[model samples]
Target: MRSFPVRLPSGTRYWTVLDEDLAVVAEADAFLRHVRFGRDQAELTTRTYAGHIALFLRWCARTGRDWRTAAEELGLFVVWLRYGTKEATGADRPSTEAGLVLAGPGAEAVRKPARIENVLTGVRQFLLHGITEKAVPSQVLALLYEVADDRDLPPEARGEGMSYRMKARHRVQVPRAPRDRATDAEIVALFLACRCARDRFIVLLLARGGLRRGAAAGLRRQDVHFMPDSTALGCHVAGSHLHVVRRENPNGAWAKRQPPGSGQPVPVDVLVVRAYDQYVLERMERPHARDSDFVLVNPQELTDLHLRFEERGGSSTPLGRPTAS
Candidate 1:
């Protein structure tokens, strides 16, 4: 089974699951479509959910177990998720030939606890959606969740009474690690290593501006307000800031949803402003960039740069084809 990308006539894209025969799995397709359209989730969300669901379905098929029955024995699945090799888990073709070296007791587990937890979360959601569609038995819910009371909750969370909640039965305990941040020296090194003003601006935007790669790439020329006061541009924001508005971008870049009542624009420092100025000056030298409204324009050379960055464990910000003007 595989996760397949689908594009509609209206240019909306999403992901669905395909069976071994390459036919769309109807149940998986319906659930993923609801996740993409009905729940109004990002397209990437559908892609992720589709991949996880496909894995579960493929496992069920290979093991000759019905999906509903597999839910009851999910502990086995968890073991498989942890220690099963790619060939054993049916993620790769089975080999008939003997290997030169055999895996010993010291072989590391296939997946981390956190990754297994994510897979279980997707599978549980898929099963719940199946229940709503009358395709799964209601009894499976008992196997998946346990009822718990709020007796151990804090006073504020108890809410004046003994409320109950359904807790998931299957969960992996993941260890928390300290969040890592780039040092000043590392940031300076990255900035100095950039070959062009555009690359340098991208480095600063990610390091200092606290902008995600997608949000930084999705920025439009109109979103930037560099002056101390921008009343003339009709923006009420006081300082040099960038508005991160959520909309469908041609490059498939999406800003994460902001919290309610927190619509303030992100402020930028003088250094970032200077970097933007330099980038703008360099961008104007390229005749193709003159007609584009987006703040960042990708050229063929930049596309090659993106590949190298990704190979070096850095994420590529650009998602669309190189555009001229």
Candidate 2:
């Protein structure tokens, strides 16, 4: 659409503004911000959504397809995600059609099932958002819910009339292998490997108490109470307990489930209490110990010790996984 000079009856000339295509990226960004601030989702969550949605938009732009009206091609979108090839070296681009499945040079890399599923879910959410914002027409929005898996429902409950046209949303997701838990012997060996009080205490804290690494790291001095009755304001638990507090810690640890300003009490065994006492009385009082409220801090990299302690606290961040045998 071009703007032409319009002659006015009173000898004045004027040009009308021409409309252009909507900026998809800008629109997507606005939607992302709405997701971040409006939905109160975590930074990492919003970032993942942005990455997935951006790929879909990029694929649409590269393939010259109207993403708004491409509901019928959703299956094709999944296929393209798995085997699409772009002609770039530094970064790979998404393509519409599949090329030769070569293992060597110029071959399109196939994505894992999980990754493809994530991208498709992101695209689905984006289209739904478009419908809510009126960027996409209401008619096309019906395609989003066109797939329904109601086989488990009673025969009378199923919408027999409208359900025929509705296909299953996507393929079944790939099953992941079960994670193996650390054995009791392994836990004992890990505890034995620690040379210092802090390291030993951290290991005991996780293996015995089943505290996540972040929860352990986020612990404060007030959180640990060896005595059954403590003077701390919020320490009302019966046994010797350490509270997992969600705080914006000076050090970089965070509680996973406990929101900021909340706390979850976890009981500790007598052995764990002894370890805590040893850490506080003997090792933590060392002159070189960093002045921080965090329960676990490395006086030195314990991984460099004689036993070569390669456990979580010694070398890097706490392993966080529960030690379940």
Best candidate, lDDT: 1
lDDT, candidates in the order shown: 0.81, 0.62
Residue 84 error, candidate 2, Å: 4.6
lDDT tens per residue, model 1, 89-185: 5545444431112347887878899899999999999999999998899999988999988886777778665789888898899998999899999
Indicate the residue-level lDDT of 310 in model 2. 43
Residue 277, candidate 1: how far off, in angstroms?
0.6
What clash count does candidate 1 reach? 0
Candidate 2 is scored at a TM of: 0.63
Q: Each prediction's TM-score against the native?
A: 0.84, 0.63
- Pairs in steric clash, model 2: 213-320
Give candidate 2's whole-model lDDT.
Answer: 0.62
lDDT of 2 by residue, 75-117 (tens): 7677667665443210243232333222456656468788887
The lDDT, on a scale of 0 to 1, for candidate 1 is 0.81
